[model samples]
Target: MSTSFRMPSIVAALGLAGATLLCTAHAQIKVAMVMPTTGPLTQYGDMVKEGVTTAVEMANAAGGVGGKKIELVAIDDACEPKQGPVAANRVVNAKIGYVIGPVCSGASIAAAPIYNNEGVVVITPSATSPALTDGKNYQFIFRTIGRDDQQGPAAAKFIAEKAKPKKVAVLHDKQSYGQGIASSVRDDLKKAGINVALFEGINAGDSDYSAVITKLKGAGVDFVYYGGYHPEMGLLLRQAGEQGLKVRMMGPEGVGNPEVNAIAGPAVEGMLVTLPADFSANPRNAAVVAAFKDKKRNASGAFQLTSFAATQALLAGLKAVGDNPAKVAEYLHKSTIDTVLGPVSWNKQGDLNSFDFQVFQWHKDGGKSPAAK
Candidate 1:
C-alpha cells in the first residue's frame, strides 16, 4: 500500500513538470533572419545578427510581445540571389510571419516576391536597391535603408562638387545593387554637368581587377566610384596603390565594412563611402548604445542600428495585431513608431518616409567619420 501511494505521487509530479515544459515551448513567437552566414559578406551578416539578437533580448527582458518570448530563426542566403528564394521558402515552411533581413539588395529583391505571395512581412535593414519597392505593390516588403537612387545622387553631388575629379570612372559588379546604383550615379553626374569618362562592369568573384585598374589609369580618371561590396573595393584599392596609380576611390554603403581595412591596409584611408547617418550618437539612444557596449558589440557599424530598428518594427507590429500578418502589415503602414533610428513610418510602397544617407571618409585605423567639406 505504501509503494502504490508513492508511485501515484511520483507520476503526478512528472505529469505536472511535462505540462509546464509544453506551455513554455508554446509561448515563443518566431521571427526569421535571412542573411549570409557563410560567404565573403559573412561579417555583414554577423553585424545584422548582433543587432537583431540584442533587440530580441531587450524585448524578451521587458516581457515579449503579447506575453510570449521572441524566438529567432536564422536562415542563410549567402547574399546570393539564387539562394534567396530558397531561404524565403524555408521561412515560409517554418510558418514564420516576420523577417528582419535578406541583407544584400540582390537577395532582398529575389526574396520579396515569395514573401509577398505568402503574406509574410519582411523588413530589410540593409538592402538599398530601389527596384525592391519601385512601382511594385509589395504590401509585405519594406526597408529601413534609403534607396540607391537617393544615395546615388548624394554620392554624385559630393563627387561633382567636393572631389571635383577631372575625369570620372564608374564601375559596378553587374549585380542589381551594384549595377543599379552605378547607373544612377552615372546619370546624376551627367545631370550635374560633370562628365563620366568611363563606365564599366566587372564580374564580382574575379580575383583580378588589374585590367579595369589599367583602363581607369589609361583614361586619366582621377576619381573612380565603385558600386559593389568591400572585397572587390579592397582589392581595387590595394591593387591601384601597388600599380602606382594614384586616384581617389568612393563607393556606396556596401563598401563600409571594417574588414576592408584588413584587405586594403593603409590604402583604405581616404576612401569615401556613403552610409545611413549615424543614429547611435543620438542622445535618445544612449541606453541602446550602452546595451550593445555591455555585450561587447560595436553598435556603430553600418547596419547595427538599422537592424535593431527593423526588429523593433517587427515586434511592434506583432504586438499590435498578434499572429495575423496581413493586419500586422496594415498596422505598420499606418503607424509611426519610435525606434532606435527615431520615429519611422513607411510609405505605401514600403519605403521609409525619410532616411538620411551621408558620406563618410574611411581611415586606415578602421574608423569612419562624416566627411568634412
Candidate 2:
C-alpha cells in the first residue's frame, strides 16, 4: 500500500515538471541568424553575430521582449548564393519568424524571396547590393546598411576628388555585389570625368591574379577600385607589390576585414575602403560600447552596430506587436525605432532612410583611420 502510494506521488511530480519545461520552452522567442558559419567569409558572419548577440543579451537582461527571453539560432549559409535558400528553409522549418542577416549580397538576394514568401522578417546588416531590392518589392525583407549604389558613389567621389587618380581600373569579382558596385563606380567615374582605363571582372578565389596584375601594369592604370572582399584584394595587393605595380588600391566595405593584413602584410598599410561610419564613437553609445568591450568584442567594425540596430528594430516590432511576424513587419514599416544607429526608419521597400558611409585608410596592424584628403 505504501509503495503504490509513493509511485503515484512520484508520477504526479514528474508530470508537473514536464509541463513546466514545456511552458518554459514556449515562453522564449527565437531569432535565426542566417549567416556564414563555414567558408572564407565567416569573419563577416562573426562580426554580425557579435552585434546581434550583444543586443539580444542586453534585451534579455532588461526583462526581455514581452516577458520572454530572446534565443538566437545560428543557421550557416556559408555566404554562398546556393546555400541561401537552404538556410532560409531551415529557419522556416524551425518556425523562427525573425532573422538578423544573410551577410553577403548574393546570399541575401537568393534568400530574400524565401523569407518574404514564408512571412519571415529578415533584416540584413551588411548586404549592400541595390539589386537585392530594386525590383523585388519585398515587404518582409529590410536592411540596416546602405545600398551599393549609395556606397559606390561615395567611393567614386572620394577616388575622383580625393585620390585624384589619373587613370583608374575598376574590377569586380564577377558576383552580384562586386559587379554591381563596380559598375556604379565606373559610371560615376565617367560622370565625374575621371578616366576609367579598365573595367573588368576577375575570377574570385583564383590564386593567380598575376595575369590581371600584368594587365593592370600594361593598362597604365595608376589607381584601382576593386569591388570584392578582402581575400582577392589582399592577393591583388600582395601580388601587385611583388610584380612592382605601384598603384594604390581601394575597395568597398567587403575588403575591410583585418584578415587582409595577414595576406597583404605591409602592402595593406595605405589601402582605402568605404565603411559604415563609426557609430561606437557616438556619446550616446557609451554603455553599449562598454558592453562590447566587456565581452572583448569590437563595436567599431563595419557591421557590428548595424547588426545591433537590426536587432533593435526587430525587437521593437516584437515588443509592440507581440510575436506575430506579419504585424511586426507592418510595425517596422511604419515606425522609426531608436537604435544604436540612432533613430532609424525603413522606407516602403525596406531600406533605411539614410546611412552614412565613410572612407577610411586601412593599416597593416588592422587599424583604420579617416582617409587623408
- Quick one: best TM-score, which candidate? 2
The lDDT of model 2 is: 0.88
Q: Give candidate 1 misplaced runs (Cα > 4 Å).
A: 1-27
Model 1 lDDT per residue over 206-232, tens place = 888889989988999899999999999
Model 1 / residue 211 / CA error / Å: 0.8
lDDT of 2 by residue, 197-308 (tens): 9999999989989999999999999999999999999999999999999999999999999999999989998999999999999999998888787778999998999999
Candidate 2 residue runs with Cα over 4 Å from true position: 1-27
Report every candidate's CA lDDT: 0.87, 0.88
**C-alpha TM-score for every candidate:** 0.92, 0.93
The lDDT, on a scale of 0 to 1, for candidate 1 is 0.87
